[model samples]
Target: MIRKIKLLLLLSVFAIGTAVADEGMWLPSLIHKLNINTMQQMGCELSADDIYSINHSSLKDAIVALDHGSCTAEVVSKDGLLLTNHHCGFGEIQQHSSVEHDYLEDGFWAMSREEELPNPGKTVTFLISVEDVTAKVLENVNDDMTEEERNKAVRKTLDQLTKEAKGDSHYEVYARDFFNSNQYFVFVTETFRDVRLVGAPPQALGKFGGDTDNWMWPRHTNDFSMFRIYCGPDGLPADYSKDNVPYQPKHSLPISLKGVKEGDFAMVFGYPGSTSRYKTSYGIDYTMKVTNTARVEVREKKLDIISEYMASSQKAKIQYASKHARSANYYKNAIGMNEALTKLKVIDQKKALEDEFTAWVNADQARKAKYGEALGLIENYYSDVENDKAREFMTEALLRGPEIFTFAYRVKPMVEMLKDPESNKDRIERYAEFLKIMADDFFKDYDASTDEKVSAALMKIYAQETKPALQPTCYQEIQKKYKGDYEKFAAQMFNKTVFDNKEEYLAFLDNPSPKVLEKDLAFQTAVQIYEKYNEIRNLVDARSDILEKGERLFVAGLMEMQPNKKFYPDANSTMRLTYGKVLDYDPRDGVTYKYYTTTDGYLEKEIPGDYEFNVPARMKELLLAKDFGQYADADGKLHACFITNNDITGGNSGSPVINGKGELIGVAFDGNWEAMSGDLAFEENLQRCINVDIRFVLWVIDVYAGADHLIDEMQIIR
Candidate 1:
């Protein structure tokens, strides 16, 4: 068939070429073909086989994609001891904490196996294998097919391929796209579900500087947490079970007590969530202008609403801590990223690159035919900044900004199931029970007064800032229902909606009815917002299709134009290896930052009464004791944190920072404030990866927490 011939034409293997140090989230499996030489030449002592060999256990085995790849964790001991960032495990920690047991305020340490807490929904997945399945995926895809048809073909291939790959096997399979769907690969993974919390330093140590110190350099956050995995007696994945045994990992990284030095080879191995180095200039501007601004503004208002309640009540603080932290993180990141993008003139750079690309395309008939419309299509789509802003703010304000909308959206699905004419009673009852459980979790963290204030404020912004026509029908209903008084509107919705009152909410589930649900205020608001959401979405999706194809061709054309320049795919929440060095830099004109920070810096930043900077008594005593046991650096001082030039992003948090010999020396935690724009453009000198020196993590574990049984499990290096 014609499809078969097209598939054969595209079946050529991807070969390894050179790449830059500051960019690229390279696939581990392709290290043997693409990155091995550069990595070795840059002082990597290990061979490619040691990094990602499929036929043997390699460094990849020690790394795990935590909870569907939101973050990364590393195996540190044979008995499945896992180490990750405190914030990554903050949700679980918060789940276990209460007014009586304030673990967030005063950390948790398990002295015995019985003391460790089990997390029901928590899971850790290990990469079993990765193989390219691009040819099979694209066999049915052709240049003449519509984008939707092509997408369907690819999806079908992926589903079929995944089914075949996993066929009755315990392993889960994923067929992920690379380079904007230009290439494809299948990843097989084993997920261990019986994950338990082993130990964690109190918030004082784990989140030392709090929000003020999140993405900044010269940092002093003890941003690490500990957990353990349990599996069946046969060493396979299992759900939480009291009888399950500790999982013996395929490989566990050996902890190194010796700390990193400036210019030392540092390589981070983990699942980096995403990056857009190849994103079209349209995306960059859309984000930099309307999207980022909308995010920062709306989140600031949302934070104000939540923080008022969180500040006065201990229970609310514990309940909303994770939610607040998650929201505030990207809120701050957006603030800095907007500033960095403008200051760095990244837009200019992108425009220049596109300029050259246009000239290159127009220089030849064949190139013109292939890439002629790419730049114009991108530029023309992004030209409508007002409409883009309207679309973006509607999403930020109505769809995502308010918390109530979350439950409202979910209610729609349940309502649909209720409306099914021949709905099974048993199925409906089970669904009803599930809704009850969901309501419990929602109300446990819900404060209607706070959410009402937030919803009111954000809805005002949505109404005023966006075009009147672009505003959701809820806005018009607010006018007709409550004379545009947001507080009155929110009050009415919350007061009447079954969602706010728990008992009433669950009672309705006993005999769920479509007629009653349709009249529900919250459900009606969800319907109106979703309707408006789709209208704008249709407007965006039409342009997005053109942008997507243009971008795909732009990237391919860019690679061809500069054949000598090494190319790598963007990060897509898959396992990748990015290598660099432990080096400090001058972030601004006259100031220079050191490569590492010690416990001395920790004490200097501490304030007795300040919640963000308060130092604990034991921590001060240990520092004054002038001894770190065996966890101190070569200079006999305890290094709390260190800096690296390793390229990383959000999901790389808690990733293992390995030395030349494949030893875990630190955990990549944060990036410098100077390079908030690193994801858009890699700043070779200013962009630094902030990591917690493994020495600090171990010191807190073995000495501060006195969890020797946990420490004894690890293969510690002197």
Candidate 2:
């Protein structure tokens, strides 16, 4: 009788799979699963076979390389020309900017190949391949082990794998969970450490639209930057080398002059950062309603403060640029998410799915007994955290408040000690690293007034909410020590002359004196504050474990409830491929957008005398002269269009849009406003990415900038 019952239970699980088999949310088994028949029903089309043939040829040749700071770039030329988004290369570009050069304002051009600027310590990576290693990863974890134990064991196993596989190269290996931890895939990446800047457009061109048009559609932004990857004589990856040559790529997308039209098939291929469609209704609703709203409000308030301060001072404007950019991005995402949730009715769908899963779990006696208690635990914890969210934010603010001031104080003492002959080697070396970091910060366009305002506000927030025992008199201490002499302090700390050579600084960290240790209190304080937060965060995380486990079981039950069907798990920053074609839209309230815009639109959108929207005189002249030449599309309208149905997000900016023929068509920049909810739930009804046509890029190089030498290297096709 027991054996018969077990067989019946297994049969029931198989039965459920058949029910959900038809849902479009299932993970596709192959690339062809994204064809027109399947995707078109969701408003995407398959590219023609000829186009696919071409794109496959080109895409296979493009080498996927990771850039410095976890960003990605692609090598597009044999001479080591690299392409990435302006924002991705913003730091490097800013490093080269100065009062005389002002590269940020006027842009940079290599008058000749030899004149290209070189940046030290920047690197790029190439993704080799992926393999399934789930069995090896989870071999030590048994069903009897607690979730924490399982997690620790899995982490240790993956770390061992990475260490053993790393070899002598600077490669990185990631053990990624797939299908909600039911499976796993391991990725091995080869990284090159030598990368340098080649050229970049001025902020006016690269970030032309700025804050106003940032998240809005019908954009005319030209957000591109150039870099080069350097390698040793043996064609192996190397650190910064003056004698290095450009690393050759297995694939470089050819430039295409074919413009996209309405209903034309388009696809994008790149690493998308994340998505959260499989989340519980509780989580999804909270993000869409509570978190997003609060985030937008915070950013809006911050932006107002920044704008007010910047208007009165030039230094303030520069200092607040980074803050403004960060806030603007969040604000844009919040607004987009709100719009998408409403359009897709995501909350309702999530609730319905949850309800179905709940019914399934309750029907099974074993599942009911196991998850029944877990569900209550999850709910209780979520309620507690919801009440304490504001307190948590306040605590985080206090911990980060003294970051700048601490660096300023520590750098001076470290530099002085390093210059001494008796300085410890290890101590000096550590100080040198700190100095390098300080240099990066000092070079940044920082607005003193804005920083002061932010500091004041943060301190006030901390004072109001923090427990007295945990609070520090940071603001008072800062004022007392600096005594309105921040400029002198900054100069002493960052001036290269004071620090002398790197060797001297390395010695200071090794034989640190009492004074140096006392000065390092900021670092100590930071560590202590982080530890406190970590304790609280870990408690919350423990509670969240119950929620995750319950959700996973619910997902499994849902899967079992439907037979012969597949469902793709939520994205967790792993590599994924989404396919689609280019198409136009009629969003709402009589708003009609074409699949592609022309150079005329870019010029027409320019407001005369407006610093943000105004086009440079030279670019305007080129546009008026109709010097499109060979870059014009098939329609003779200057092929400034292409299409794709690739799934992407913020990290996907500057990703190449390749055709089936394996030719470059455009660069992915942003998603349409209607698809902002795509990060949470992909709605085939609205999600589409916007890209800058490669022809537009070519035209900018050939006509506007007269960079014919750069243009001659590309395999431009009609």
Candidate 3:
């Protein structure tokens, strides 16, 4: 299964020895100093100030962070009409969906303002500014201080600084560390709480090819979704209200129907989440062997159970669509990432880097005193992998696997609240109300039969794979009482458990008692799982300080050793800019993938009856007519999706793919499967960012869905 031969055949380069051209997610504030000249040389017509500036309107004003960097969106209309990926907005879409409405199947479009759907917790965050506060945050900590004391000092400083930053403003302030706590920055942001769902295409169009096409090239998925932000008459953020009006943003990106070509300048601006490009080889090995492998095994089984039920019922299809897609997305990524990392020999390359670092330290006594033990610390910690494997299996197979245990765990706070009702009367009342909301949400998507099957298989897997001592108390009870017959035990538990019905559960909460909860099988199982989880966590915690300090020192030493190389800080859910040109790649010896996919490609891949490939009759008719309107290229081909070499990660989903003139061309949604290892090490030639072209987005909106009224709000250029 090792693909080193294929790797050698495809790539002439041995391994990613260092950062190469078009790498690094540079901070927007530092673009002038770091990336502007190179970007212009590549084809960019915009200046640094045009991309990011405080005194005037800039591209940053249009880019918004959704739910604190979970995804990105851009303003496309003067009235705050927003555009992001279908998958990014899937949760809200699922929440509004029902068996009757079936919004996920037949998409929703708000013809007017009154028809728009409002989501409760959804918010669009705009970055006002960021300032370095490292010296202030670390002012009270010392090297000699213990980790606990150091944390306390840092928290106190951050709290004070955040308070100073907020003042009388309504903006939210966040201070986060960079480079494993070696640097820090305070961010000021304004968040609009009233975000309304405007339009989306049906899954047949938006999620075309679903899991099979995710993270792969030649994608035809029109992954875009639309939303709008509303503000008060004063043009400030406000909660959802009838009185609120459409927000007039400082800037909006113009959509260019003039499509992307090979080697065209492309830039992505978004809030990228975490990446451990500075991780030690030991850490990479642990991820590959334990974490990634465990996920691959567990999620595949989970997906099988869900997929079976989803195929049989439309209810299951809507309920588990989000959950299934999430699990499957990472499942494929892990399988591909493990193979890519091994084939690329990233671990060996990292070892060579560390060896050179060791030599550099040995040459100087002061350097040795500072960094000599960093690698040893990492090695000693990772040597405990034998202990870590069982913990991973137990977590994946038991703690997170069963839905009943997870639901029962929610009652832990309610149990404590009932214990002292007189002193916590108000809190208990509030929690009871919250319990109703919780039940409504969970049971909407709950299929008890599916969970029962999943629980039985996972329980047996946990029993078979784990050591006797590592198994939870519940497993021990299973062995003694049921003789390890998970099927019989699951049947009894599902039939007898109060959690199987919301009405019975709520009736008990009306006059809850500790004895009632103590005898509950689901609650009992959850407690045992948590007890073992804490045991493993404590075991890991005992050695974590050394590991943490070692990681910090390793990055510091790497920066020192390669002083001439331009080093960008690792992403930590902060805004960044990565620029590259649109290009194609050869995944294998005889196969070369084109940079862009077209409408004809969509018709070519249809499977007739498959939901992933099937489309609406209207869409097929439009394609047959070849009436793309203004969204086709000079060659008269309708481009659907395209690729660029822009450096991006998970949180960059829904980010705006901007052209040299600061016009929107696409929305980034996924990364290529070949270089899934880019999270650990950047493979410059193989790594690619996948985007849905803006032209295809509009084509689907205006022609396929007949939502041309929504198109009237945008500034589109032919």
Pick the lDDT winner.
3
The digit string of per-residue lDDT tens for model 1 on 459-494 reads 898888887788777788788878989988988888
| Residue 693 in model 2: lDDT | 79
lDDT-better candidate, 1 vs 3: 3
How do the residues 1-718 of candidate 2 rate in per-residue lDDT, one tens digit apiece?
0011111122111111122211222222223333335544544433333222322333423544345224445567776677777766777776676656767667777767577777766767665555555668757776577777877887888788777767675667777765445455566666778777777777777877777777666777777888877789888888876788878776666676766656554455555566665566667666765567656654564567677876674445445555566567768888888977887777787777667757766888986765445345445546655423543444435443323443434554454555664645666666667667655445365544454555445545544444543444443444467553433333332332212233433454434454543454334334444545566565667576676565544555555555434355455544444556676666777876767777777787888756478888877887788767777766666544333445667656667775545566777777777778777666554556777777777777766667788877767777
2 or 3, greater by lDDT: 3
> Each model's TM-score?
0.95, 0.81, 0.95
As for TM-score, the candidate ahead, 1 or 2, is: 1
Model 1 spans with C-alpha error above 4 angstroms: 1-19, 385-388, 417-423, 511-516
lDDT of each: 0.83, 0.59, 0.84
Residue 309's lDDT in candidate 1? 85
Clashes of each: 2, 53, 0
- Could you tell me how far off, in angstroms, the CA of residue 329 lies in candidate 1 after the best superposition? 0.5
Residue runs of model 2 more than 4 Å from their true location after superposition: 1-65, 68-70, 167-170, 288-294, 305-323, 366-377, 386-425, 428-437, 440-444, 461-531, 634-636, 639-645
Model 1, C-alpha of 541: deviation from truth (Å):
2.0
- Which pairs of residues clash in candidate 3, taking residues 3 or more apart in a chain or in different chains? none
TM-score (C-alpha, index-matched) for candidate 1 = 0.95
